[model samples]
Target: KMSFGTGHHATTFQMLRHQGQLDHQGKRVLDVGSGTGILAIMAHLLGASKVEAFDIDDWCVENGNENFDLNGLTTRMGLGTIRDVQPQGEFDIVLANINKNILLDEMALYADLVKKDGFLLLSGFYTQDIEDLTDHAKPLGLTLIAQQSKDNWAALILQKKA
Candidate 1:
């Protein structure tokens, strides 16, 4: 596959497992750096009213759209960073399974896109890097609500403070 996130990597697996536990019914979700659209598809399957995704890689964007098609979902998939995505108002949940550097750089943008009291799920970093991620998120008013780890990889669920 040209894209990433086939639910095989530890980070992707934890992201999927943690995402399944959330209540997605009737919610608007955003998936950042969506590779193969796995997380975006999961949101739809979980009952999210709308699912949108974006990736920096062109191949990933194409693969994501194909995956959405296969899943019978009409998700809006874009090719670029979060900044390039068209505004669709605040989301009920924002999932970013990107690396630590990108997450840290875009933390504020992600926070701004989530509705107050909504969720922000993140992964794609080592368990030891959780502190750096959390520390950066805290000031953005995103409180760490839950976390999962496997094989030194970690995923975090945070809530935007109202």
Candidate 2:
């Protein structure tokens, strides 16, 4: 409905592929740019306690809600912006599969949303963008813990430092 992520793109695929490495059990999860709600649904299935997701696209919001219904799982889906999300009190795992510019602009917000040592999974950028992203993220309390790439797309697993 929105843009990207029907689980067919390289960024989405790599995120799902590397998902198992992190512990999602009983964690609160947040999905930004939550396309078809794939990652949100997956997080819930992985045992995330509360899964919340939002997208700026009305179609994505509608489609995400439908997907949640289809999966028999309930996720808080709506239209939102990064600024609307008060991540500080809201999540333990934050997933953002957006383009390079948005990723850079909101990395600090994502880092703030996660609790100490909580995980933030990011993708939707080419491999060359990692250095700039990481450089911006380091001082904001996010540390690169893992990364995976395929066909020029890169996915990163970062943890908020305690």
Candidate 3:
């Protein structure tokens, strides 16, 4: 299979595990820092109606494109950070498995792109980072719903309040 994620990293594995619990059918998804486009590609395979992805690195964008073809999926791929992208619309699900600083800095943008009650899944931080991250996100109308951690790395599922 086309490998955007080798399922090795703790953050990616936790993110994927949580993603399995959500209903992706007909949902719209945003995979920020899409890396190899693994999350985006998985979103498509899980039946998301719209899967959009972007990364700041040229290599990631290139490799992501190749991975899409390998999976026989067509994803809207681009090169940019989440901060630089314009709002398309609120999404049903947003995935950000990037590091703590970026997650903290871009939390508001991520929250804004989520529809009311939509899910925002985040990772690529340590367990110690949760409080700081959630604290920042809460005031922006996000409620920490669930969290998982593996090997000092952590993931969280937040929902936009209605």
Candidate 4:
């Protein structure tokens, strides 16, 4: 069974809210660990020109595609990590709502995919984990610009330094 996002979790909600705050019009976006494709769909509705999403789980990839189809949106949903999926070029905005360990482990790759001065939004970690995340991000030229927390869950929006 695939564990998909229902937009009910604090992290997902915060991610959604953060995404809403940003202007996605005509932007190229990437949704890492896309789960049920909620974020990808939201990006489309927000006017992103291109959206690429992937997950390590085959079920998630399939389910996410189904969700996209149901929403009548065309999305590039694949099965694998960012390295395995190998999406080409940098994105105007990158969304990663995965856990702390995976976020840290793939931070460099994520940073590389963000266009200079573009945004990377992250969640799925505890509020206490923010410092460690930002710490790792800073050296990669990603600076924290916005943050939101619900209960113990947290989300951050970082910009790739131009």
lDDT of 2 by residue, 1-162 (tens): 445678889999988876778788999988999989999988888988888888988888888898889877765687878787554485778999989999999887888788898888999999999999889889988899999999999999988985
Worst 10 residues of 3 by lDDT: 1-10
Expressed as tens digits, the lDDT of each residue in 77-97 for candidate 1 is: 898888887546999999999
Superposition error at 148 for model 1 (Å)? 1.2
Ranking by lDDT: 4, 1, 3, 2
The RMSD of every model to the true structure, in order and in angstroms, is 1.0, 1.5, 1.8, 1.3
Which stretches of candidate 1 lie above 4 Å from their native place? none
TM-score of structure candidate 1: 0.96
Candidates in order, TM-scores: namely 0.96, 0.94, 0.94, 0.96
Instruction: In model 1, state the lDDT of residue 73.
Output: 92
Candidate 1 has which clashing residue pairs, if any? none
lDDT of 4: 0.93
Q: How do the residues 1-162 of candidate 4 rate in per-residue lDDT, one tens digit apiece?
A: 346688988999999999999999999999999999999999999999999999998788888888899887877599888889888999999999999999999999999999999999999999999999999999999999999999999999999995
Clash-forming residue pairs, model 3? none
Off by over 4 Å in 2: 1-3, 85-90
